[model samples]
Target: MRKIVYLLFLGIWAVIGPLHAQTVKSDSVFLKLQQAFMAKSVGLLEPVLSNDFSVGVYNSPIAKYMLQNIVSHFAVDSMKLKAVERVSGKNSVLFIVYPHGEPAITTRAWLNDSHKLLYVDLFDQLCGLNRYKVSTLQATIPIEVKDGSIYLIATINDSQKPLRFLFDTGADGMAMRKSLADSLGLRVAREQNTSVVGGNMQIQVSTGNTIHFDKFAVNNQSVAIFEHVREGTAGIIGINLAYQYIVKVDFDKMIMQLYSMGNYNEEDKGGTTLSIKNGKGILELPLNLKVGQKEVTGNFIFDTGAGYYVIGFGDFVKRNELLSSGFKPYFSSTTVSMGVSSPTFTGNFEKMTVGAIDLRNVPGTLKKYREGDERATIEDGSFGVKTISRFNFTINLAEKTIHLTPNQRFNTPIDFMLGDKMFSFNERGQLAVLVDITAEQLFKQGDVVLSINDIESETLKKDPARILKLQAMPSGSKLSFKVLRDGQVVTISA
Candidate 1:
């Protein structure tokens, strides 16, 4: 009995030993690190840091430059050492940092396996770094509209079959549908915390050796894989373009042009130029709005991935205070990659502006996330494609500038129910259902919707451009559907 009790005690201690060592001297060690960073004295931190420290995100030279740049600008106000081994790896400590005037930061410090300081992980800084390369001086690509969204057709590797990809400005990394990736036997590079349209998740990141365009190609690019992708799209070409070229989108003409950094000239681009702040591919600009009795301005992500017009965070929306009059619940959406969504509240603001492009009575939502939720986006809010598609825009990658020219559709009211559901064309060449992102209950996950507003699914499949435009059309604030559920035909108005 005595021997067994002693062995049990040893087992318990074995488990707790590493846990305790991970946090021991964490406060004093991080304090010294912060002090040394401000002093710019490599010698001061030599005792705590490993002799061979490596930077993870970029090449050595650029990573060192980025590191020093951050050290130089770090606020000397306060430093708090926190344990987050799960995020930063074993024996990690981080500061709950608030950059003096900039956005809140999530940074982690690294320790070697021997419990010596290895390096620091500045997630925000690393994510914002753009070393993207483009080989083309100028190129033009045709675009097709489907379900009220713009899509680009391209090839994977040397394959003859063309796959459709969304030209999304808001996505940080390029992403593909898991089903497509599985069918192609693509490699998943890693799985980590990542952001989606209006939420965040631990997503599977994949890599494609080559993504070939007509005259250009991106080599060794990484893409995230989502469980749920809208039917017809194989993946999305995200903000990766921002690192390499200037992109001009003309929806009316159904054309897209890419210009190399040196070849593109923003001076000739005439429109309302908005100076956007960016880190990684995420873009945020000053958004001015008028609530009931007060006017406010805040930085919001200019996100094209989001389907809604606007979605704000808790504090940001509270300050704007558009909910005093009790705004109604709009559409709530979530991808299968991520389950249920955060509660969303909706209302209209008197006026909203991104630079000089103005819109009146714009519908917006507040996505509610608990404080300090890792799923919470770093930005106070996001601006979606619904409002942005109304403009002809030019995004200059090298300069971090966006020019917007209002189109006639700019005056069109934001839709209350911009319904987007999961679907795929069946082997029999008919549109089949997968899931619905909206809150309304219309059909089960596998039910096949034969038609919308009397338009035949077979005809729309043959000509998807027409279906895209009609999908966005409002049917008296509800949809009339002809669905085949369990091999039985049912007509329902939802």
Candidate 2:
């Protein structure tokens, strides 16, 4: 009996000993983290953080320089370890942090096999903690449509004056022009290189800023400042808003609705419901489209920031051999993002099936990847606002679903590309030739277009609707352009 009791005691000690040690180690790590925040130093965390330490659900590894920048400028007043648990078979701890002059944040940090800190997810926590529950239960804001994108009024921290912001589902988080940030005097916390549609550029991140959309406000948010944005808009509000609220965009009514996630009813919207894939920071949806007679099925990023109907990524286009395929090509154009432009060819698709709805004769663009272009590696492409605006859509990130109901423009014919020339508005709101594929080269690239078909550039700038009119001109129609080339105004006709 004594021998059996000794063996039993050894078994009990074996079970409890490691758990106690783990608790002690976790406490030590938490203490070091708190000290780091208190001192606004990353050095205190270096000893315990894993060599492969990353941030967010996307597992983006933080380099030493970026970590130092972020930690030194972190605005947390204090941090406390609230709880520890086993999450998805990994050791995880919860922390409650108070930002100076802002609400508290409850985030989770994960530990590696040796109990070293591996990852910290702060954006998800910020979205979860910020909830809106007013008497009306929803907020409706008016929107303006310009250049095939939706724009709305917003105000940055402590400012009552309104700024124009693009409602861009393509972007992961909030972004502003560097000029706007400089004017607002926002301090940069960290700087990182980011990939945009056309090319890559370095962007600065600013934290602890509040963005207000009428009465609805997002506090303690991070904003990416870019060197360039659309000409007339101050910044962009991305899909992060849907993570906190059920977002409904009504293009026909020119309004957007925001509802609390818990109080909203998906069934009431009455549209074809589709599941949304939670990507690194973007949202994706399955797309079944038909080009000519061939069926192409894949996932596409739902991008409200993009102006065209659809654009196939280089990988998707190359794998499917879409350029050589039998589809008829319309004209050559360029896709621009952050002031960088890439060559693309626009064509018509037989039909694009979105849930039960079938959109016929839709125009799509295919880009030919440049050598060493990083965007060529993406698996799929995006559906832009020109296509999305045909439907009244509701995005509920909490439920990972999107409800799309076709509106009055569901069957409207897409604007046919007029010729082998394409133009876009420059930063000064003047039209410039982006691409000219004609054999004669009637309009050269970088030519400032003064008038097209007697419509003045100033009029086109003021009335965006006229730009669409120019795009929809019937094929075989003769067109003339008054352009500023070199130092003299020249008239070109084709």
Candidate 3:
């Protein structure tokens, strides 16, 4: 019995000894981090940081150089480390820091197997204070409505020239073209593989940046770099802005207002307020769609990045047999995203309902999935800006609610394929016919349009608003198109 007890004691010590040593090392690293902050020196952190060390809010990791830049701007004269606590899993440690005249900050750190600092998550520490926070109670920014989308002007870093950004509710964070990032000399913090509308692609990200617009500024911003974006725009201002502020868009006044969270009252807004589901930065709402006599209900993303009314995923459309259930499709085209294009069909739904609002003769697009393709499970479809812009809506992401009031364009008829054909810009900026299902086959794919409705193609290309106006013409409206096909100019009337 004595021998057995001695052996058990040795076994216990064997396990405890390494754990205790790890704890001591972790504590030492934590202390060093605190010291680095106090001294405002990045060199002190170098000894403890891992080769792949990154620091940022939860799930938003920036490179070490970004943290160094941020630290260089810190005024930590009145800051002190309050406590250090060891968390349960993955050699995690929490640091409680107290700054003079500010709220206490709690930072979480993860140590690697070699006891080097792997990642330090400052989400709890900076989420409410400096990162993406607006100093004023409210800010009013002018908005431009073009091609059924909203555009706002902003300046990146220290650039003085105003850059137009699309206010996209579908994007997870801010995204800009790689050329723009290169022009601004933004440093690449990391690379990540991300899934987009059509497919997946690897993206480059920059962190710890600032964005300024009008009278407001956002600090510690993270921007994803893309290969290209829409013409005449810088990039995208994503849903992160809505997460930080109460976004109210007034289409009639052509303005967007950003109200501090919890500062705007819904009752005063006087609109139909409805709850929304926020999952992984995507906001969704339940929608009921009617096709012929069948009714299908599903949750759809509230996406301002989509320029059309609605886009149904393959899973939902196939499950509900939307194509065969007395539904009429007028034209077929291709939808492109991130340089990947997929075939699509467009038509009108009988009716669609969202909360208390009802829309009749709603237009929707459905993707044509290839065989053996994986179906989406997260969302049924997405509601686009064309339908959403009809309402002057206020979205409060903190409260998970949206207040919507109908605007003047509420009763406007939904736009459809004007002449039983679809058009898109080709590589050389020429308007080419994309789809034509007319009985006469007046237009063929790749036909370069020379003129439409007496408007020159070059003039139409210069002013896209003219194309939209032409496309929005009511049903039974006639149009004439002149195109170059088979090396010959041909005029067709519909």
Considering TM-score, where higher is better, how would the candidates rank from best to worst? 3, 2, 1
TM-score of 2: 0.61
The lDDT values for all models are: 0.64, 0.74, 0.74
Q: What is candidate 2's lDDT per residue for 1-494, written digit by digit as tens?
A: 99999999999999989888887777777887788878878889888887546432222232344456556776778888888777779887788988888888787777877889865666333324222233124678899876558898989998787999998998888889998799898999999988777567888999999988888787788899988887788988988787666888887788899877643465445668876665456777777767655789877889999877888876677767788778777786778887778888888887777667677667788887766454533537888887887778988765457889877655443444457765665334567775567788777656888998899977876675776777677877788889999878999888
Worst 10 residues of 3 by lDDT: 54-63
Model 2 misses residue 188 by how many Å? Answer: 0.2
Better of 1 and 2 by TM-score: 2
Angstrom error at residue 181, model 1 = 0.9
Q: Quote the positional error of residue 367 for candidate 3 in Å.
A: 1.2
lDDT of 3 by residue, 408-429 (tens): 6664434535667766543345
